[model samples]
Target: MDATKMAAVGLSASYGRGPAITDINLEFGPNSATAIIGPSGCGKSTFIRCLNRMHETAPRATVTGKVFLDGEDIYEQDPTAVRRRIGMVFQRPNPFATMTIFDNVAAALRFNGRHSREETDKIVYESLQAAALWEEVKDHLFAGATSLSGGQQQRLCIARALAAQPEVLLMDEPCSALDPISTAKVEDLIFTLKRTYTVIIVTHNMQQAARVADRTAFFYLGKLIEVNDTKEIFERPKEKLTEGYVSGRFG
Candidate 1:
């Protein structure tokens, strides 16, 4: 879990022939929190999606450049296997409406080829505990996932991702839809989770980035403007664009 262990090389992505982001080179150290901050449509979300190959799910989306997972090229191998090692959580809680809480967490394991009931159960419990949802729903594992509060549902979504025991976790504006209290809880959870999983988050909230990220990368007009330690990015940015945005001059 050393913060300097994992790194990513040059990465670029586009939709059809139109480039959304380009010349993006960065590294996400193991067990560290890296935040991508930008205004809406600045390609922060697109960047994270490309990390796990979810960009391919969008029609006409195409990605180029290499994404190295512990020095191996993820883009050169089977995307499914890459995704098994890098999980994602979206802006909204997207638990399957028809499945129960326990089943939602277990589905990823089952799909990844864990067929034993005992193994699935163990993974489900461990994932839920990791996501900080086990104490609330351990007795109601069969309850519909949607029945939980917005905060709980978001945590369940996180649990579902963790069930696969991924080495990296990608979160896209994960607290955007929640109340302040719920957002605080998710923020706290992100801090706790970074001890075991390298986390890359795309967030519009500058304060959130300043609060949680060890390192911060700023995006402007689909290009990376600056990347440095969070404190420097917030307090003494090297780029005028970064200072302007952080100082509320412009996005």
Candidate 2:
């Protein structure tokens, strides 16, 4: 594989006693998008959350494995630093309610370090542009974040994450809450984003996975059943489990 931006080796995560995901070994290449697809409770979300140490935020959660970023063990680094390098977007839109659209993105830049107003402004604008929300809200940058529609709010959250200059973006069912039109917009943005960032998205929408991902991984009962080219996985899965899931015979 071309130099991977991130990899997980013998990774497992759990809440207290029972493991949610077990021994996941995967690699994500630079500048490509990978979709994790499985039925609900299949550990798709749990696996990605462990990627950036977000899994530890849960009560009594434990992780035992190695996650490497560019050949460096991320578990040995500061959790905050690891998260900054691997930003995430949740299933629902979660822009800060009190901050304006510009401020929401600016908050990420400010949190990373001190920047002059001009520098912050430039980054905020560019981030918004990257999320494809600039033209819609440029004139009202100071408007409250909650004022935007559901789709706009989700894109704003994406812009906020981008403002942090992350190398990888993890999206857990990012469009599950949006209408079809909004979902299409986010899909377009995903296409644009994979050109620069290594993107990993966990989605239950098989069609969405087929549309947006270069590769797709299927998980079943907390285990990764198969990982392969999107076309191959959908059309000709190597494993029987993968074939059954892709063919809608079982989840």
Candidate 3:
């Protein structure tokens, strides 16, 4: 599948009364990873949600400005198509409790409705392998998804997203609820996935951002404070605010 570059222009979002993020502009290249780093309620989550049209799904939420996927405006495209091309994983592992591990991955392919049973099986296997989960779950494909540990569940969710063959993947604090070992596994998976998929991850863990992201964007109350290469962002940030936040002086 072809990877997609994403850009936001004059972007802003609001929950009816006040804006969550305002006039933010950023560009992400294909097959790269960019981390969105900020404190709680800094609009990091809202901003990533807008990338794939998830923000507008919230009640009373509205977005202004444009998000472009490979130069085409996402807002002007069909919402279902936009979402299909961009897949999301939430903060918590959210496997369908009733579905088997294989079914969970197959469900995404089924929803797209173009693949035959043979093709679906192939995709599911490949996705699980891509997520580095195949070795652990291959023996229990038909078992309940919730039977896996928290980390395994998260990896299964990633495999499900991969099964869609999305051009872009959006992850919102995907490792926040996992143990240190689980978090490290996910981090390694992120590093590997960027070789083929453009990934945007919203995370509160600064070190995780440093470990996984090639580029880093720092957000503050409703605005983007700074963005730069990961090394520069951590070592020699141009903005004092960015320095303060990264240095643990203040958030």
Q: Best by TM-score, which number?
A: 2
| Local accuracy of candidate 3 as per-residue lDDT tens digits, 11-129 | 99998889999999998988889999988999999999999999999999999999999899999999999999999999999999999999999987786778888999899999999
The local distance difference test score of each candidate is 0.89, 0.94, 0.94
User: For residue 45, what is the lDDT in candidate 2?
Assistant: 95
Task: Assess every candidate by TM-score.
Answer: 0.96, 0.98, 0.97
What ranking of all candidate models by TM-score puts the best one first?
A: 2, 3, 1
Off by over 4 Å in 1: 1-6
Give per-candidate clash totals. Answer: 0, 0, 0
Q: Candidate 3: misplaced stretches above 4 Å?
A: 1-4
Number of the candidate with higher TM-score, 1 or 3: 3
Model 3 worst lDDT window (10 residues) = 1-10
| Model 2, runs deviating above 4 Å | none
Clash count for candidate 1 is 0
For candidate 3, the per-residue lDDT at 81 reads 92
